[model samples]
Target: MTEATVGEFTTRASSINRALDQIGDKWCLLIIQEVLWGINSFNEMMAAMGVSRGVLSNRLKWLQEVGCLRREEGVAGSHRPRYHLTSKSIALYDCAMMAITWERDWYQTPALDRVELVHLPCAKPFVAQLRCACCDALVCLRDVSYQPGPGATRDVREKKVRRRSSIAITEVRSEHALYRNLINVVGDRWTSNLIALSFHGLTRFEQFHQELPVATNILSDRLKLLVEEGVLEQVVYQQRPLRYEYHLTEKGQGLFPWFLTLLQWGDTWCDPQGRGKPMQVTHNPCGEQLQAQVHCSECHGVLKAHEVRFTLDGEDMNP
Candidate 1:
């Protein structure tokens, strides 16, 4: 379908959309990850992420402006200031865990394999798992429902949507970086938005275009990329004229936890109008509003940043 042929449809300026608007770029996410790993200085992030100095500086300022990061005084004699995660960004820990879980499930990430996530409460290395806050049952894509909430309102699409960066996250030089594949999929705003919409049961091309309203070519390209990455599979839904519908593969559904955690974080930190959450997610099994919690697979305890230790090569890394 052509962009002009597609009809205008109302798209909610949901918390997730707002959230993506702030940190959806590859450079922005890489910068955040670097800071999370305690790589704080401008030079450090630039070198570690293999990002241009201009881009790194811009993303750092943007992150600080969005409240995801804050600038702090340099230590001792260092003249360069440090960037620290705000409470808003620290809350992204669960989302990060979910991303790691999905990455490990789909790819043989050497960096992630060498690192162990130890649940201090359990004192055992554990994989991250998502469970519903209502009944503690595991959350699956099929067992969830979406409903419009108080803040449901149309987003004003820019007449000229800013084009996303073409640079791949895999191009980043950080061998210690986790979630390279996940970042490649979601680092672009359009790709990430499509993934989020899939969780709401959007399947057809027309349905996706209505919610996203990007140029048709851009939409098509992202869908094609998703298919190539094994996150989506195109199913023949109509025999005539070769019409198809896109459905999430098992790999795609595995991303539900990451998006779920991101949604919750956005609800908490990205509501500019305080209109309340734009969407209400219900856990079908428990019949209660879905509250996502990332926990240890071994002990089933909710994870806390301070209570988890990351070990690399048998040495404990910083919390």
Candidate 2:
């Protein structure tokens, strides 16, 4: 593997990066999703996720090592082992919902369309929505501001990082995934990092390069992919020598909820040093700290893991 500098000079520590380091891989996220949906056995996960035996085994071990999953003995007389989500992994439920919401909004995901989400508290079908806990107001990317938090530190990144995977998400063979498009975008560590940096108002290529410290070619390829995916649009900023600035499109802005939920999850579960938080976000409209909450669109009630159920083909699949 070739070496890539994550950061040459000091850069602010980010919970998002830490979280990505653990679960940002394409297979890793998909495996976690499968386990969350009750597909925990090795063979079950392999068939459901369309992942190879070796890759699946590696990711399963990695997940266990990272505290996202735990290996448990199967039922009495069974020889196979099973995987289960830990509290840390379960906390990612909000991110998953936001991802589903974004995917349904952007693409015609038949699998997602067939699956129905029901909020048990309200006893009604609903869509997921993000709201600020401070005032119960809908949270938008435009209305959020952030600054360094107590956990913020100048991080000197590792000099050697793995090269990005060559395989594209669309090329992966998955038959039962709800957030395929979302995965296609953020499944890669660097791609997700770019999206996170964009939320911090980064635009220019040089700006992203400085913050990410990825190889120039890899960074360029990711940017082009984002543009092709319609998440980012390039605007001509200079005519001489042809310079441009990247700006998020409407579709990209729609991902704010997902990223916000992920950031909160990272802050809670990925902080190894117990540093408070890497960044503090404030709701501009409410003038209070932003505390994100996922709620049901139909009832406006907060969503809890045990308080949600899924229905597929008129069959209740409660988790």
Global lDDT of each model? 0.85, 0.85
Residue pairs clashing, model 1: none
Candidate 2 lDDT by residue in tens digits, 1-319: 1335554555688878778778887888888878877888999988776666877888899899999999999789899999999989989999998998999899998788888888988989888999999899988899999989999986655544766556565665654578988998998777788888888899999999998767799889999999999999999999999998989999999999999998899899988879889899999998988999999999899999888988887787665
Candidate with best lDDT = 2
Candidate 1, residue 184: how far the Cα is off, in Å:
0.4
Tens-digit lDDT track for model 1 on 198-242? 888899999998877677998999999999999899999999889
**TM-score per candidate:** 0.93, 0.93
Candidate 2, clashing residue pairs? none
Error of model 1, residue 75, in angstroms: 4.1
Model 1 scores a TM of 0.93
